[model samples]
Target chain A: MKRGSLYTLAYAAVLGLVCALTLSAVDGFTATRKAANARAEEVRNILTVLGVPVDADAAPQELLRVFEDNVTEEERGTRTFYSYEHSAKGFLRAVRFGGPGLWGRVEGFLCFEEDMRTISAVTFYRQEETPGLGGEISSSAFTDQFEGLSAVGPDGSPGIRVVGDGADDINEVDAISGATMTSDKVEDMLNRTLEEMIGRDGFDG
Target chain B: MARADKQACATCGKGVCDGKGVVTFKDGVWHINPVAVQVLGICSALAVTNRLENSLVMGAALIFVTVGSNLFVSLLRNITPRRIRMIAEVAIIATFVIVFDQVLKAYYWEMSKQLGPYVGLIITNCIVMGRAEAFALSNRPMVSMVDGLANGLGYAAVLAIIGFFRELIGTGGLFGHQLLSEAWYTPNQLAVLAPGAFIALGFLIAIFNAISGANREEGSQR
Candidate 1:
């Protein structure tokens, strides 16, 4: 073997070994922490959507505690949703959802009122839209508008719409001014997910 | 070998305290500052400086990667072949970047989300490669490490200043805290966006150049 080629091979081998070792070590060490964080975030999101008063800076333990005390996971047939009993109302349901966003998948939890028809809140957990534009889908200014809006009409049709701001429709929420595509996609996501939920045996009233 | 000789040695020690690596420290910290003096690694400055928290984290990440890659590059300087040294340097730089990325994702999950694609983009950051090529490739490991750290700080300092103004004015807050009274002051919405970053960075760069220029003149006088 040529001397330089031999050096190159040695360099490549050592570099590969070192890189693999470092990456694997980090991955192993962080795997549990990452999982715990994801779980805590999910718990927090569920609580937020359910209107279960969670401090934004609450510890993970506190979040888990709140989630356990207030929320219950209900399974019917092959579908599952988080349920919380309201004092005045019957029960609220929340489902985790994900769909195509402008840049990537947008994922969040959508909560419903006791009737399972009115959207109580919507919280996006992950989105890849533009930060100031399409990214506003995650913003409360946009998501908050979905509150008290009907997810389904009187005839059981999906009536949710992402309309321009200030249009007179009870079923429509304002689209983010510059994020028309993201708003439309979010509307599509909600309608599609709600339709699927309605088709399931447990979701039908 | 008497009392006078001992006293003389003590004074000399104090006078020459800058010793071996002090010049490297000085170079990294101020005179040859990576961001201010060399004008490298401005992408993260623009992207992360919208918020102080993001800038601080980005700075620390840059420091970790830069110092790590510099040390490794300097260590392997002798053995690395001329033809493929860039490739070797990139491998080392990328390994550190990924390690930093994984650590952030694991520990500071929210921050990882906020930073989004910037952490992974560290491998492409010009400052890391710039330091490795210019200093680490020729220097000893210790010096290179110092250079790396100094450059990271320089970059971080600039980002922090930019973030301070952007967050304070754009959002009427600091680190998302509502410092400005809402009823009195309204936020400049433009400050939170990309074009705002460009304008803020431009003025900051101008101020930095003026200060650095003055420092240069003072150093020349000395």
Candidate 2:
């Protein structure tokens, strides 16, 4: 065999073999941790945006306290909330949140009570916005405003739609001040999520 | 001295035809500058430049990717054929990108998420390929090694300067913390956007070109 031919064959095989091995190893190393981190971040986002008291890097327990209503996912699309059992106690409901974004999309979940009225926990799935300005929608000041508010709209519909408030009232969100589009998008997204999850009729509660 | 010269002659071609370091230097400084010259890897610079702290982390990642790929390509240059060099180059680059990506996740998860797709995009960065083909392929290992270092350092300096301005103006902060006093003027939101990267880079390139051009003229006259 020619020297060049032998070198080329061996090198290609070795490179290919090494790449395959590295790909598997990288997947193994990152996939599990990445998934867990993603879940935790989602939980944190929901908690933060809903005005729930959970740190951005808070553990699952911090979120669990508020999200005590474990609503398991319905197989036949019966219930909107995902329910799960707690420490040998009762169940809890994790309400799903979704909305259009200025650029792409934003989604999240907030677990609440059986009445589907009071806030439980909040998290965002996706948000493509300017980091500090629009992205601050994830801040507690914004979500904390949602806490203790009626889950139904002004029309008494399920899932309240956020409208811009002229005053800096604590109960009403101020519409992200300069970021009107982002604010509106999130508001509409919340309204749409409520409409889809619940119903056109007012909250049965 | 006598034995060294004899060994050089008998070798397949490392010492005989290797580039005398100039090609690698040019690759680092002129042809494939990480910022202005080649315009490669600008996404990370834009995304992370919001803070000097994040930019430093990003720059370090860039350096590691460039150096890791450069070393591997040079080491395997003996076996890499001319026909499929590009294939080998991309594979080597991707391998290093994964390594850096994993490292970032393990330690700096927040910064890693902020950096997002830039780490994965390192595989497509032209600086790595440009240096690998132009210098690493034609040189000894040490020369190629130095080439990667110089490029990385140069790239980092550019990132730091941009980050300095963007962070100060955009957020009145450094590394995501407030640096300016409360009395400072309002932050310039424009500097934080993607378009700001283009504007800042344009001015930087023009200034860089002007300064280098003046130096050349002075040297010639002298």
Query: How well does model 2 score by local distance difference test?
Result: 0.68
Off by over 4 Å in 1: A76-78, A154-156, B1-20, B214-222
User: Cα miss at A198, model 2 (Å)?
Assistant: 3.7
Cα lDDT of model 2 by residue, A62-145, tens digit: 555555542234542543546554333234356666667887777777655556665554556567776667787877777666
Q: Evaluate model 1: give its lDDT.
A: 0.84
Listed in order, the DockQ scores are: 0.55, 0.39
lDDT value, residue A7 of candidate 1: 83
Model 1 Cα lDDT, one tens digit per residue, B22-104: 77777776777777677777787888888999999999999999999999998898778777799899999999999999999
Error (Å) of candidate 2 at residue A56 is: 5.3
